[model samples]
Target: MDPEVIGAIIGVLATLGGVILAFYLANRLTLNDSMDSKSGWRKELMNIASKDEITLADIYRIRASVRYYPYPYSETNQLSFRWMSSLIINLCDEYFVETYRDKHVASYKCSNSSNFQPNVTISPENDEIVRIICRYLLKYHWEARQKMQIFRRGRDLMNIDDDEPSEDVARIIQLILEQVDKINSSSPQNIFQISAADQLKDILNTAFKKLTITTRRYLSK
Candidate 1:
């Protein structure tokens, strides 16, 4: 080959190598950033779950803010309210699912639900999730549903067998149903699984009583 041709080939090879190197570095950086972000999220969630007490007000403060963004990134703020709901339940569900998976609760349809049941089985860890669910996810779900355009598929899966939500008991019933709705609605991508029924028999005790009820006849018994 001519000397000029050989020189041109060498130049092309150098440029190609540079491009490949740049591409690899860009992808590696992205993967590292992604892993870091996930790690941060898990740490925050565990912190919340680990707390002895937290209120909706505390959660509002924790919501990723606007004025403070890491180099102008707000993608984390756009996370669906549903995913936030899932995080609490999903994190707690992992340990229990292996040891105490409730077949009926997993399969329970929400449309016909009378009252929402939570497994108050009380794990040494992650038990606070019950309070989080009752306090935030239940109310937030009702509020969030107003945003989406939902096509009516059927009458309803969940129902209250008691008097139509006259006093505050009705509100309690509705909250329970919303939770079951989210749980039953879980899929491979978005998890919201939590046990229901007589498993967590004491669930109606402390955190729940303080959540949304004013006074209720049904809950008294």
Candidate 2:
């Protein structure tokens, strides 16, 4: 080959190699960032779960901390909401296991009133938390429905009944559904409005009571 042709070939080969190396590094960095994010989220979840007492307030704080950026609507926010909802549900299960199952509360003395409560006052901030919880539960139920549909389509290959949610989860979901129903029926405009603070307070109060009662009944039996 001519000397100029040879140099041109070398230049093209070097450029291609640099582009490939850049692409590989970019992918590797993205993977690393994703793993780090997941690890941090897991640590935060476990930190709450490891607590001696996980209150409704703790759950609220966790939900608030999980940012749903750009406010109101985004695919990233939706996924974050779903993951946060799952974490909250798992934490509730852990709380039940720690407070009742592990303690053998059927044979131990336990107050039905002392299970879980919102430590915060009935203010707009608290109302926002309740609204978030309501939305999370709604999203969870919707996701569960999607899962059920998928299971139904594959029922011949898998036992769909095996995917049923736990009794505790079912009960809590029922509570959320009932509250959501009331909110839907009575004050549609008051979904998350601070102006509808009283209505939100009532919903939260009822939910808290139901949860406490359910926990009590489960522990009693």
Candidate 3:
């Protein structure tokens, strides 16, 4: 082999090795940065979870109005009922479990109302939502039963300031109980742990409709 030709071949080989090394380093850097970003995201998720707690204070306030107003006659009562319905919908949006946090985090936009608008792209597994819903249902039933007993016994409710409102609340309570019972019974708790908030809402809405119809019929009687 000619000496110059051999030297030129060696130079080319060195350049190729240098390029391979550079690419390897760049790939490693990119991978490390991605991992770092993912780690940061995980931390942010934990922070959010720690900060958010679901409360039913708003529902209680609405319930108070139902206790004092008769039927749908009062504008305030009607408004409160609508607000209560919206509160449940809003609560469902706000209390999504861990899996939904990632996508929700990306698309969340704050508004003047400070309302939580869950991202459409976010879908969480059902158990978390279902558990919360079940808990709510249990409370609703217990409260409703207590109120119904009071109404049936013709006992004056101690804290009730208005008789008509007490009757309305009692009616609403009976309706809610009937609906919750129907739903709770139809969808056995073991029917595949709740996988999404929508599923829970479906169970609630279906049962609630039936309950409302039954209650209205009784009211007419």
Highest-scoring model, lDDT: 2
What TM-score do all the candidates reach, one by one? 0.23, 0.25, 0.20
> Model 1 clash tally?
8
lDDT of 2 by residue, 1-221 (tens): 89999999999999999999778656655664586477664455445544544445555455544433322222222223333344344333333233224334443344466563323233233333344454544444335334432224534211123322244444444444455455455533553433333443453343333334544444344
Task: Please write out the lDDT profile of model 1 over residues 34-118, one tens digit for every residue.
Answer: 8647756444544554566553332433343111322111222112232232333332333334334443355354336667553
Ranking by lDDT: 2, 3, 1
Candidate 3 lDDT at 133 equals: 34
CA lDDT of 130 in candidate 1? 43
For model 3, the local distance difference test gives 0.40
Each model's lDDT comes to 0.40, 0.44, 0.40
Assess the local accuracy of residue 103 in candidate 2 as a C-alpha lDDT between 0 and 100: 33
Can you write out model 3's per-residue Cα lDDT over 27-88, one digit (the tens) per residue? 65566457647755333323322333322322222233223433323222321333233334
**Stronger candidate by lDDT (1 vs 2):** 2
